[model samples]
Target: MHLHYLGHLPPDDPLDGYLRFDIAPQLGVHRTPSGFRVFQFDFCRDVYLYEELGGAFRVVGKFFPPGRRMAPGLVRPPTETEFQNLTYLHRLGLNNGSFRITRPLGYNPWLHCVLVVDHFDGQPLGEVIHQAIRQDRRNRLFRKLSALAEFLAVLHNRTAGDWTVDFSHPYDYNGRLIESLVEKRGMARSEAEEFYHLRENWRARTCMWEDRRVLVHGDATPSNFKVGPGREVMVFDLERMAWADRVFDLGRLAGELKHFFLQETGDPWAAEPFIGHFLWEYCGYFPDRRDAFRSITRRIPYYLGITLLRIARNAWVDWNYRRRLLEEAKQNLRAIP
Candidate 1:
């Protein structure tokens, strides 16, 4: 879980009132939406209390980079729209959901640099599931799983094709997006030819495109969500929202549901009984597509298997927090039929 920090390096967005440096803000004079302000609102969540006051909020404030303890290096400032888009994407959620990953609270169009979404809230589904299992209360497990399914259904229903990003070569990977997925996740590394052939072989696993496509929230991990006071699942942060494979999106949900179910039961084989029930419940919203849905179902093992492998690969990079993860990864692998 490396949060993308592309916002800190580039042209600073004067519109967003962002300044670049490793300087931690002090309770001092910094302009706000109003006027000169001594401090900003206080944030109390995720084990940290951050109040902006009396200083410039640098791009690299109170954070250490990956390999270095000193701090991230200085960089060129951000441009106008570049900065604004970052803020808009981040704060845009405020208008729609309870949270936004905007670069800065304030806007400064003059400097282009903006912030990345490092914000993680909402009890990670994993943590939430773990606590429930520890307390021997898996009653709401199905309900929560259904809730997540609904969220995915909505997102998959809206995946658009027009929207594009800079890095991705859309011209190259349109229909073959699954191939890209295979390569990106390192799931089909048997050989280059084998991976290519496998990718070419995977047909559109689902007929989710029968109705329409809007926007697919690319990443829907539990950590990306946050539960409001009443446990309302407010889906926020559309950083990866885009036109994408409908099966890919739903496949992810199936994999997650399988992981949680197997975790609670500790038996990979026990997953099948509930899986049919879950799929039935999931399709209640996006009805009349059992064939497409089941295609994704059968492939859940591939997705889940690759996902577990990725965890192992990530663990080798850093051993400090491997125990809890290693066990889960192995369990996921075992549960993958």
Candidate 2:
């Protein structure tokens, strides 16, 4: 293999050997690579590897930050969890069809916990949203949102399981975010307390537990999904994937749409039509679409509120914007439906 570095390769990096010796066999590339290039995407964290010959292979390697553990004494690393999640979903038939995901190639714990997967050539959905807002491409945005809605609906419906929907996870998650706002972001304790009580009210709603658990993307932000030229949706970032209420994904997506519109156009209501369309499209995948729509809409507000609070925790967001998010979240939480 005539390996070339287009970006910095860390000292004593073993990635070349890992790809040549471990990943090559799985890819059926018995022949030596005539030429190869590696480009670091995010400093030392992500790299794009390309083989000019030997079938012109291309893959992205993601390196998990060291010292991060799922829990005390848990040997399972984030790399393993993500690889297993990807493999699990792939086996469930998400590797092809209209809805897809980056195919997991391999993972090397020795090489900085690098998880390798097929490199997707698609535009990030976030960028698409930006284009839609800036260029007034409402039709294009509608089509993409429909595709995403279908993708998520299929994922949740196919992965529905016997496990019960646990409200505790979301309750704790929201509480923690509020606490962080008060403790770290200088949010008033009274405001945080009010949010906490509102969250508690949501927890008491029996509608929250009506649905069976399904595998949710966990992080359904626009940046985590990509839209191909054919408008196919491919979701990634499965590190947060878990069994939860299906709306966990939908509401986060809705929250993102609302946030983008508010930030870009200074109109929160601008996203309402699209959000309605997205959720309505999602309901189409169910046997009783109307019932599904009614049930999901009833529960989506809580998750949307949670997503808003989650975004508010980000330090990069302007303090005023964060406060607005908190207020929006409060209104959603206060909804009786």
Candidate 3:
């Protein structure tokens, strides 16, 4: 097979509408990429829900990036290399130790595997950010994060796997991940420094532990959880759930707090209080990993930079991809403490 350039599409250009011609294996269903508000349910799992598909039927789809396929829509949802990382909560019967994540709700003008998840209503972490912004209160954020850490602690106790059995943190160490990014990603020198520090701070290798483990949601982020009625907090995506370091799960959440939620309102300080609550709420029981929390929190800026680079690098395929990424890099550095 010869390598052919799909060419670059600018960030503003519609990623779903790119031209796919003959001489290539066609990807999944065809559809416009924009419009729906998307968020995550697990590692490499996401859902874009349309409240009303323009008066037709409500539409939603679970996206899998690493495996490269959409749940029930076009064979491939557009944008195979989506910008952000997919976090917790997977569709029913995936890897979460169950066969029923959702019930086939019914049909829509769009696709199949229509899931009618019973009691499938909950506010994702992203939505909570809006609420946090509204009331000028960090309580909800702290509460939610607290629930998440507690949940992880229990999951850690319940899940039992052996690193001697199985392991799955794609990047096991700081140096390994950094070298790959620098080589394959061609990362800038400055960005490399941040990535290096973030990786080291987390003691990245600890995230690779597979043994002496308990069932974990592997990737715990706001987007992966929902606050249901009655203050019921339910987790959705479990694609990356594993019996591993508690820090891995919380680290993911802490890192996200800096990037999407806190930064959006330009209130980095908003993360200040929650950090303590998160660690205090979680580490009380899992005393083994308390230092890990402190490390993760302190390294959030570096992690944010790493995340921005991931976004910037992919966007580089499009015009100004490099320039835009460089700008983000500069901005990211300035945000550092």
Candidate 4:
């Protein structure tokens, strides 16, 4: 609810800060205070503006503030790679028609932000899960899940032979993930050590499993996607996109589903059906269904563990629940088939 100004703007007109970019001139600016959010560690500020082009109201200006300084005392800012990832995924979505994503309008280097093609007009999938209407929308849920899985399969198939695997990536990424939980979220050092041990064992067990890499929507939390009429799913925030095992995305989403249900109903089992439905729908696309299912079953536990550990970094969760999540993640790691 509290606002923190990050960008250096002119005292006369804050909106004028963006109009300086040649990409498009802003005719009107409207700030959406309620829409601003913190995704992971990134502090995001949003604004809706009407562009002068064709006098049409479009362009969602997203500002990524330099929340913290990175290595070598350099400020961590939005990179062009993420912008490219957004564009790539948008084009991929348009080509397949399986899903839709916010289009990248342009990137402003000076402002440390980017303008998206549109401001999403639908409720996020996370919100949809909490709505009572979701019970009546079960069929639509399946439709959305099916479409999402198909798109993921398409992406994996298209990039199967294109990317090379880096075995050290998971270790490095997961290490940093746990460290953030411990340092920033006050996770107990003992739990952090346990997670590290689990990671070590998982690395040995999954030596060859992480070899197959695909273009992954690295941050696949429910908040990153929106659901519309007909269960149409539109994804945004591709900043964490990378070439990794597709299971990473699946596991993160599944863990989110589990976490939400556990928090809402105090029973993780309540989410099993939806998680099963998603995985089953995803496996429908594999040519060798049995083998793919086997692999997914065996390997998803590791990714789900990683996702749970990552989820523990959220400050909003109570300390007790966060400990339970860490314990659950450890159990998932130990139960890996």
Candidate 5:
């Protein structure tokens, strides 16, 4: 994480007086060897912690990126509304339900930056999934999935709205997926046209989906979630949260589940059972499970294709695998009915 070093611990601190006083007890007497004063946040955000004169650790400060580096040289800065939206989303997460999340303590909008939140401690779901699995671990995983589904249901129910796509859309969220397929993934013109045609067909087919527009955890990769002792799930990285089709999240998760299992066993088939179980658990939240299950089944393939295409654009994926992802996306689009 590239952090903008505002100041040192004691004197050079640019923090507001109230924040400084709040964290004064937790400020260490000295800095680390590398002059590093903060803990691991994320690539685009800066997270600062205060380990008290005693030993307790608490997150006191966070600086969100004015601009994010998308490609090697491309930097995208968020608008004022976009930045404020993130803080509001975090507040919503902190206030809602049995789901665990970083508690929003405060916000500093002077530079249109800085959000303060309480640090949360838990095992990253990605690491837990990557580890060796036993029967006990499997059962625990199922429990966590159930909790996650319930949590998402709560979030969706709380924030459902008719947010206009072109007006309120902060991220250019869905359009970027199309951009990735063509520009980033290097799909042939004809292939890209066919992909767009298929996407439009699928969209036209399900455009009448009755599910209310709700806040979706736009990025649902395993790394964004953590599981605690009681199998409680905590999610972070809310910059992608948006009011859209909830299926966007469900499909992204399913795509990630498939991707992870495929990477682990080198067999696409290994993901099928887990994917089915996850979808089943998620559908259990709706009163009409059969209708919900059928609706999700119809819609998921489209978003899953979007997820697969997005993954294909990643630089780390080798040529052959990228081709596979593109192929899978096509298969998904073709299967949509």
Candidate 6:
């Protein structure tokens, strides 16, 4: 991973006081940090604060892009939402365990609306997956998948609520993705229309409404999870976290597994065993494993198809590869009947 260090901030920088006064006490560091070493990552900047007394701390800060607006009338901005979500999850006993989230330190609206949280130590699961594929380490991949499945199960099961599942969001999201592909000239109008019909068909499936609403990771991409030395998983990027079908997370992960295998090994079917193992492992956490497996599998195609379309719409992906993703998405949607 490429990381660019921006060097230590000057003494007059406001972040210095924020760290010294606000964050230091929470971390039990008595003295002010001498300086902060800032490193820019793909989506956020990590600041490492060091004190003369040998106290050191790592905190991640994310800034929202200018003109980025939430849905109309939404109360909280992205930074506040993420901070609250992290705090909520931390209070739910996810602060320490095999499955946990990074601790939220504080949000600084004056500092570019930055949302800060404790830094998590581990490798992104995306890199782990790439290594497994390159090294032919199927066992290692399976173990990591198992750990992720367990973590997700605990997250969903522990936070399941009585709220009704909002199936419209997925339908609208899939439609918007198709429209974006058409606008980008990545897909033809006819292809987009056909995908729309497929989405409608998926919406009509009763299985989509069979499960209760649960707190889903909302963005279950491999890059959002960190894997420690013991295969422990720490999921972050909670800005999109919300209540939805538990399979929403699972199917996205399954689709990603398929995408990675196709991109790396040139075989779509190569991911089947790992996907099956992941879903089976997720179901193991529920009371009726057989029933849960059947229900989750039946609903997986919709979210999985949506995930494939989501990836296919990205301009960075090769055109031919995006076409393959579109075809795979169609196949999954068509298999629902």
In model 4, the Cα lDDT at residue 33 comes to 19
* Candidate 2 local lDDT, 1-337, one digit each (tens): 1224575434355777677667766776787554456665642334456553445577777776576556644467767788999999989887777777877889878777889887767788888888888998888888999999888888898999987799888888888888888888899988988998888888888889878999999999997899886658887789779999999999999999999988888776888998999999999998999999999999989999888988888888998898788888888889957
lDDT of 6 at 302: 88
Q: Give Cα-based local distance difference scores for all models.
A: 0.40, 0.82, 0.46, 0.67, 0.64, 0.83
TM-scores across all candidates? 0.51, 0.91, 0.51, 0.79, 0.78, 0.94
Q: Give candidate 6 regions above 4 Å deviation.
A: 43-55, 65-67, 71-74
Best by TM-score: 6
lDDT of 5 by residue, 18-135 (tens): 3445333344434322222444444533556643333444564556554544344223333333345556766665444457665555565563366665556777776666662423
Q: After superposition, how far is residue 249 of candidate 4 from its true place, in Å?
A: 0.6
Candidate 5 matches the true fold with a TM-score of 0.78
Query: Predictions ranked by TM-score, top down?
Result: 6, 2, 4, 5, 3, 1
Instruction: Compose the digit string of candidate 6's lDDT tens values, residues 29-78.
Output: 77777777767774434333233224377777777645677675567678
Off by over 4 Å in 4: 1-43, 46-55, 65-76, 90-98, 132-137, 162-164, 206-211
Q: Clashing residue pairs in candidate 5, if any? A: 26-52
Give the higher-lDDT candidate: 3 or 5. 5
The root-mean-square deviation over C-alpha atoms between each candidate and the true structure, in angstroms, is 9.7, 3.5, 12.1, 5.6, 5.4, 2.2
Selected candidate, larger lDDT, 4 vs 5: 4
Off by over 4 Å in 5: 1-10, 16-19, 22-36, 41-50, 65-97, 132-136, 162-175, 207-209
Our model 3 lands, by Cα RMSD against the true structure, at: 12.1
